[model samples]
Target chain A: MNTSSTFPSGEIQRIKGCCISLPGNDIDTDRIIPARFLKCVNFEALGEQVFADDRKELNGFHPFDIPINKGAKILIVNDNFGCGSSREHAPQALMRWGIRGIIGQSFAEIFYGNCLALGIPCATIERRESDELVESVRNKPLTEWDFDLNKLEVSNNNISFKLSIDKGSLGMLINGSWDATSQLISQGEKIDKTIAKLPYLNDFF
Target chain B: MSKNTLYDKVWDLHQVGQLPGGSTQLFIGLHLIHEVTSPQAFAALKEKDLSVRCPERTIATVDHIVPTNNQQRPFADPLAEEMLRTLEMNCSKNGIKFHGIGTGQQGIVHVIAPELGLTQPGMTIACGDSHTSTHGAFGAIAFGIGTSQVRDVLASQSLSINKLKVRRIWVEGELAKGVYAKDLILHIIRTLGVKGGVGYAYEFGGPAIKLLSMEERMTICNMAIEGGARCGYINPDQVTYEYLKGRSHAPTNDAWNKAIKWWKSLCSDEKSIFDDQVNFNATEIAPTVTWGITPAQAIGIDESVPESSSLPKNEKAITEEAYSYMGLKAGQEISGLAIDVCFIGSCTNGRISDLQTAAEIVKGKRVAKGIKAFVVPGSEQVAKAAIHDGLDVIFKQAGFEWREPGCSMCLAMNPDRLEGRQISASSSNRNFKGRQGSASGRTLLMSPAMVAAAAIQGKVTDVRTFFKTNSDQSSKTL
Candidate 1:
């Protein structure tokens, strides 16, 4: 089900290997990378700020100073994993943070599309299954999620889940293409041929 | 199969071309832009030496990065100024209409479009911001796109897309007193678990929906994205047509009647089939608030936080995490969490109705000391309307900062923000960690009136109490 085939180029990227599980919900784009960091065009440095706002100590207490999820490829988040405004850089930041994909009970539609375009697999499961996955990871920090690229599935022994992706999103990722402008430009030859046959597109050109 | 919902009908009609892979080429009828996401998209076009294929289908505005306090030139932030200038250049270069700040029409892109009637029934609307779903109020199939997709629309006037399944969310019974459209959406989100609507478009219908005004319907559809629906919409009806009639860009005379007929045709039939169906009793909904990191992690104002013991082992862990992060005692009533700040604005509940409701609570009272409260109008027009009615002065006299319209503290790209671990009773969409612009900040989502009440009491309090028996003998005499 080529979920990554039809997007514009560079929209779909592949991250190989096992997964890391971060099960927080409503982790917004700001914490994915603080707004202060957005002034720069580069997305490379954002992964470090993945949970910036939460890392601060509360006065003297360790408020959210937990260690990074140690290179988990796949992230299993709770319901509304990417809630809030549409910030495309969010998935970019998370992708750079090395999260290859997300499996939540739900995702913000725009963020879901952005993730799919960027080749970050976002899948949904029932709340019960999501809750169970959330539990499995908490019990074992080293829990590994293995994603089968061909099958488009994210699973481990304790929790195996199938993903639901729209054909365009799935196709674009699989084909490693989404920068369709350039693709359109490159398809000039084929477009020219098709247009010539149709005779109507001559007016548009 | 049976008759199709508006969602399915619109998706089918907009299917320009379907590829073998299953994703369809979806045509967009309108494209709205703002300064933040457009500069890069335009730059991409320049780099490719491509022209905007159909500039007439697009409109641009400046909202994000526009300071609500000051409108001076060459902004203190060089990047913001540059972005603004770039947007100006791009709009002119491509023959697209740009609404700059302070331009009577300058407003949040979401608010400006519908108010202008550029968004209509059966049209596919796309913007770079997620709140584009606000246009669904007019029964348009709106979706928030990305910067690259923004480029796509600018160049092609269409989106390469996959389709979504349609779900019919039917409501029965009338809402209880004091319940607004905001409460209805919250109830929907709570039942759907934020992610339940993924891969689906919600068709809101029923006696309750039919009873709502267009503006009230807008509020319901505005937050559909928050619950993970691609978009939620009511089928166009007399209310929808009335709201669009005589609007700045609405069709006129014979064209108006023609458009109305088309809109009516797009509505779902009584027996429309859906991928799924859910029903809610509007009377059962209550004014709700978010307690933890997520919108779903909340209970009604009358309910207490669920004890961790009742949660599953996994939820128990997150509950502990939320407890530690939010600094709240387990099982404590969510009603009186001490709030240090109050923010009343956002694409969600920052409309004129929300402002009017908040002003009702703040008119004769003062914001309690030690609480910072402000009301940022959703758009410049909303600000103008509020001032026309003297609602601004009522708020200011009561100690709420009356500021320029923009997506203020909602996401905080601009200067308005929260400080430290201040817990804010906000009317914005999300209550995620640092969502209101401070790393250690905490936010509780509520209606604007509830926010006003919190500002007055310096804590999360029931809003019904504010309106409850306020005309009593002694207090009224004073």
Candidate 2:
């Protein structure tokens, strides 16, 4: 199933693509996008710098730099992916790098929210499932990997495994409510109603 | 139902609504914006044709990219100048208050907020910078948001977020001499692991936190993000109220009495229960410094780094990575490792108290011949105060450059950068590889006083030694 939808008003129910696996725990945001790239004025060019330093140091042999993994749309990472920094550029860069979905053992809190806001689904699987998925993607880069958000399952032709996304986050993904800014605007009256009672906020009024 | 924790009390009060998901729509009383993350957000707002809903609620400044060495217009770096100019334009366009350089109001975003009394107890604060948690020192539930979230806050003045579990970190006992709030936080992060605070709001309290000054509390809360917490806070008490009494934004007279009453009521009730509880002995903490890439990989001043085999299985790989990146063996002692640069600034430890502590250590001493040592105040106000106290002169006499206020060398967004593989003694929060700008450079995170001690010796020296040395020198002079 295609993961991306029409801009600003759609849900990401499923994602299907070839996977590029990067295995390591606590793979922080610094490794994901590096701090230097954060100086840019916008998010458009971030994709080129996603893991730029790592790719450079590892040269042509790095997974993302390897010929087979070029343009791989799904990334499978180990535990605690995107563990540091509040930079949205990390997720924006990953998305710009052509990744539509991520499956890992876990993700940092802010990173997960940032991804969901942009219609990028970040799902978590059991350690064994994660290991098998990583191995499958690494050994067979051409194999189609399918992630079904509704079913909470990921599958290749040879194997299938159940993954977990928090129920609330899952609802947001399925129902297209993840664009929190819109939700926030729609609830403007509710915010005003609450603010009316606050002593501190009342100062401005 | 259990009595509400401090986090619960503050959160429930600020929560605007429950969203379609289980997340709460929390109203942000204050939104702080800096150059690096905000220009894109403002661009997004322009794309959406949206005006800031509550411009008065937002405050803007040029920090992440503003140079600490120079305060002139049209910054040296084109990109840096562009970023600052963009921030200026955005703030002016949106009618948000801009604390620009030379306004005597600008500094590091986190540093300037509290000193200006913009950060207060029981407030729900959001910023695009992670150290926004620094304001939590005032008992506010402050957190860092991404660029999109910044846009959201600017447009709506609220954020949709899942409520976090509250973890009460109880620190008891008096701290030993030379072990400051920085050491305490480093020690806490070391013990709990960097990811330990994930999905939790750390409610720091007990005897130790209670005794710390407001600036020290800010220093501790500033690095809560380093420990992976969404935010951290201390319940506002008499010390907190006293610190806010005469500040610019603080309420006065009858309004002050009313605000204090409300603030007092927001403190966690004695019967409040936390989702998790951890205890630390202040005396057990030493002057600490990070030896590895992550803040959690820290050791005591006199301790050696852990061997890979000695570490837990889950920690071994990262340890190995740190070894390779830092170009040091696993079991080597962190001290006496020669440092090329010493930075005494950042929201984490760039306050007046932090500078005072560092100045005392560097008094009657000169920095080593090869060391590049400098001090950057957290804000222009901090700079003016330091100059008035002659702390600037003391630092300059010790051969450290006394620079203007900004986030200098903290992330090296400006010209203050580490070249090649030079090692740094940084008072800033993160020590990630290349975090100080150069690809292969290394950073050892420590307190400002420890940094001062390191600059003088040209190596990592325990700050307590310098404390004794300075006192002895003074006694002799007298």
Candidate 3:
């Protein structure tokens, strides 16, 4: 499926790639794409700076700097990934860095919404399940894993486990209904009618 | 029929319709924009050949990267100047009102709105900045959105979002003398883990919240996002109504009573059911500060940084990471830690009252030698008011640089930043690593008054000590 297609036709049913695991929990947006990098007028080229400071501090020992993880397409994170700041650059940086999907115990609400907008499906598994999956992925580095949206499952051929996602978000991922702007535009007449009835808005318009 | 929660009342009133994916198409009553986040959003609109759906409903300002020292054209930082120019051009092209530098109306997007009476009760507000929840103090349902969502709002004047469960956070009793609203919020984030409010809208009420000024309430709701809430609000009351009265955008004369009546109705019903409930005693809260990266990793002024081994299982790893990143020893007392800088401004605490409180502490004192301290008001209005009341004189007398109104040193988008390994006593929200510009910089979040006390001592001295000294000196003079 072409997850990158704009509005209406694109849908993502599955993500297949070797995963790179970042074991930290509460990995906030500032860490994902630090505040200083947010100064740009546009989000392009942000991939080069994703975790820029952290990578530098880790002295090339970080997972993202490791040669084996260079082309990794999936990211396995711990609980509450993307927890602070409403900056869209966090997800933009990740996608630009070639990460196609994320699996974690949980995600910040706004971050979850942003990923859906960009067609990045974020699935959740129980803590124990996520821990085991991450361990397996680490043990057999570069082994391809499949995360199937329709079945809500992740597998590495030998081991498999079910995951969870809100039904609405799952439907949007499967059918490509995450193009909320298109839906919003389609209902333009209704919105106009509603705005006309708002007392405060009447003065402005 | 289900009794409506505050979230439901606001959500139902503003919802346009439910989309195919079950997300509601919510109309945005107010859309706030700033230079850092809006340029790309406007560029996205240009990419699609779309105009702003309703320019009249939008307000633009330059805050994030605007230098606070000199109010001049062609800033020394070319990128900052370029960003401001792009925002100005976009606002002019779209016919949206731009509160540029020296405009008097210009300030932090979150600060200027409420000060101008543009933020009101029962409104659904959206902004590109995360602290947009600051508007929730007036009983509005406000939240931060991404650039993509900002583009969506600019094109359609609406947003598609799923409904959130309501959590009532009941804070009771009275705050101690030196403990302020910033302390209260830090305490809340400390109790509820960083992600505790996921999928929730926190309804802050009870005697303690009701007693707080509108500015104080704003400080509380301002950092609600730090606790992972989608948004946070307090029901409108006499305090809320009084603050909105006689403002530029608020209704006047005959329309005033009608507006109040409608706002009054927006409050959650006494017997309304919440998805979850939590209570905190105001008396139990103390002057608070963060020692770790996440806002939840906070302790009272008299408390110590938690030992990783002593932390709960889920908190151990982050605690260890924070310890290493901060270069702080576990179990070390938060007090008496040397600080290199002190900042008193942000959407979180850069209000008139906050400055006034801090000024009272610094009135007859001077900043400790070798400490870099400064105060930036939330807006031009706040600066003008502070100047009129001699708060500027007090801050200046104490050696704090009185700068122009903008989000200076809050996130370090401007020239104000912590140089390598410099630790700061800041009034801004969030202590995340590198949040204040330098990769190795450290931040200790606190109230503005606490920041003043720290500036005087060059360390995390308790504000209560200053309070006692001030009173004793007053008695001697009298």
Candidate 4:
């Protein structure tokens, strides 16, 4: 799917891809990638297992199993997407399955942060707009969508909808600053200073 | 925009610097790692040629994949064994302290930290597990992080995180005899929707909170992630100091007194401002049970499932999905719904007190004929304590299997799991679809005592009906 096995990296200012809609609120990480799949030491084998249970339950009737939805890179979802379990496996599985971006009514804080760390943009829109987008995608499976972080909107040739992401996250996504380890490591002096000043670390002396 | 709150004070203290992308480089005072989420992070460190900045501050434990029944070397499942071994190797290689199986200290990361007093006030904690919020009960600013952020913390002892607004959740009045902290938190989640705390940290305060024990407070904060809050806390007080006074990692001698003074100072100021505030009457919260997939889809034990037409338009989709998946009809009473399994364990409600309370309910009663019931201690220390108190004996005599500690049945990553469409009365934090192993397995989340009561009757019966207060001990008959 998508013919690209390379992991996402660098600035992610825009994501243009055919969209797939997954409707339902509070679709937790367990449903995304079941706990049984997390037994692996590495995340390499998780792609094929994304929504493994849900897909199996639906028996090819699920949106992800539909032939037309194959190779879709953008995921459209409802409220509180990725609501439970801080397991980054959920987004890692989705990303491995070719989802470069997610548009949802809202996202859990940890899930949103996990997506950002992997360079996946999670943009939010109003419930009405999300419903309309899901409807549009269902009416015309595999509708191409252009999601622009700079413009804070998602659009096709005929229709457009505004999107919202925290300004800090937006800036990081566009500037490739989402990979936060290097930046944090660069502030070595500041971290040392903070640690030295902590009361608990010093035994309260 | 909250001011003078414990969150603000802790965030300001832990602020290492400002990052280029407008996020704060916040120093992590404590970094916790577990088998499930830390392997990739450790591997990332190797890939980047980086090392753990503060090895002493980071702790590791094996929980998620450890089998409760047979925790012998080279576990029955090779994958699970490999994960645990990888974690052991990672901890040893990185010079990080690890609490592995048979260590007596090993248990669920969230449960072990507080019991050992590694969790403290005015500290910032981060773990890859979502229930790391459990540390917030000690007045720490603890939250869950993804593995990438875990790598950041390992490499730098800090994270580039955006600050969160603080919401004060005030609950007045004391809880009734049968209602526990689990019920109160479930009620809170039901009242505020799961995503209500998406962008805010919750400050649980008020008289009702003050009345809870340290373990009970941990129970409330452990499920903060389930309520969509990255962190939840109650300011440290006399109760907090008392709990940490004699633990292994707590301060000694004069330092203990000094720590108390500083911890007390970290409480939210009387004049502190909050981004949002909500209030609930603790007495109003009954023994709550989840009827749907989400933690928010809960109702009092006496209430019935709401009809789809009665719900808001936005809720109809998930509600319908829940009704169909759970095999429950609309307007069905939750009380008499049969349960095939009863599990009492997790970072949420697997503490010593949770076990003691549940044991009290099933002390003389046998589990319903066909029901498979068990109790899993959250950690080894919890199991030890429970055994010391003879709670494990009570549990076993009541037809419940008393298993070893480590997140058993909570995520069902271990061998313990549900079969087919079996519905379980669980004290775990989540009730998500497929959360308990089987794709079609069902879970009804409640307090440990409620789960015990369900085991006795093989249904979702209210714990209140079976619970007898100390004053009514002479008439203690289920």
Best candidate (score: DockQ)? 4
Instruction: Please give the CA lDDT of all the candidate structures.
Output: 0.75, 0.87, 0.89, 0.91
Cα lDDT tens digits for candidate 1, A59-148: 323212334355566677765666666777777667665667777766777777777656677767777776676676667756666765
Residue-by-residue lDDT tens digits, candidate 1, B263-374:
7777899757888789999988777888877666777889887788976565676677678778887778998889998998877877898899999989989999998999
List candidate 3 segments past 4 Å from native. Answer: A1-9, A202-205, B1-3, B473-478
Candidate number achieving the greatest lDDT relative to the actual structure: 4
Q: Over all chains combined, what TM-score does candidate 3 have? A: 0.97
Task: Please give, for every candidate in the order listed, the TM-score of chain B alone compared with the true chain B.
Answer: 0.96, 0.98, 0.98, 0.98
Write down the worst ten-residue block by lDDT for model 3 chain A: A1-10
Q: What fraction of correct interface contacts does each candidate retain?
A: 0.37, 0.53, 0.58, 0.85
- Give the candidate number with the greatest TM-score: 4
Per-residue lDDT over B1-478 for candidate 2, one digit per residue giving the tens place of the 0 to 100 score = 3247767877887788888866788999899998888988899888888889999999988888778777688888888888888888888888999998899999999988888888999899999877888999999999989988999999999988888888889999978999999999999999988888888888899999999999999999998888889799999998898888898988877778888888888888777988878999998889999999999999998999889898788788889999999988966898899999999999999999999999988997999999999999999999999999999999999999999888889888888999999999999999987888887889999999999999999999898987687689999999
In the order shown, what is each candidate's alpha-carbon RMSD?
5.5, 2.1, 2.1, 1.7
Rank list by DockQ: 4, 2, 3, 1
Give the winner by DockQ: 1 or 4. Answer: 4
Better of 2 and 3 by DockQ: 2
Best of the two (1, 3) by DockQ = 3
For model 2, the superposed segments whose C-alpha errors exceed 4 Å read A1-9, A203-205, B1-3, B470-478
Worst 10 residues of 3 chain B by lDDT: B1-10
User: Residue by residue across A1-205, what tens digits does model 3's lDDT show?
Assistant: 1233422237888888889999888998888898778878988768888998889899999998888888788899998999888888998888888888889999998898888887888899899998898889888888998988888898877989889889888887788887677677777898888788776665422
Pairs in clash, predicted candidate 4: none
TM-scores, each model vs. reference: 0.86, 0.97, 0.97, 0.98
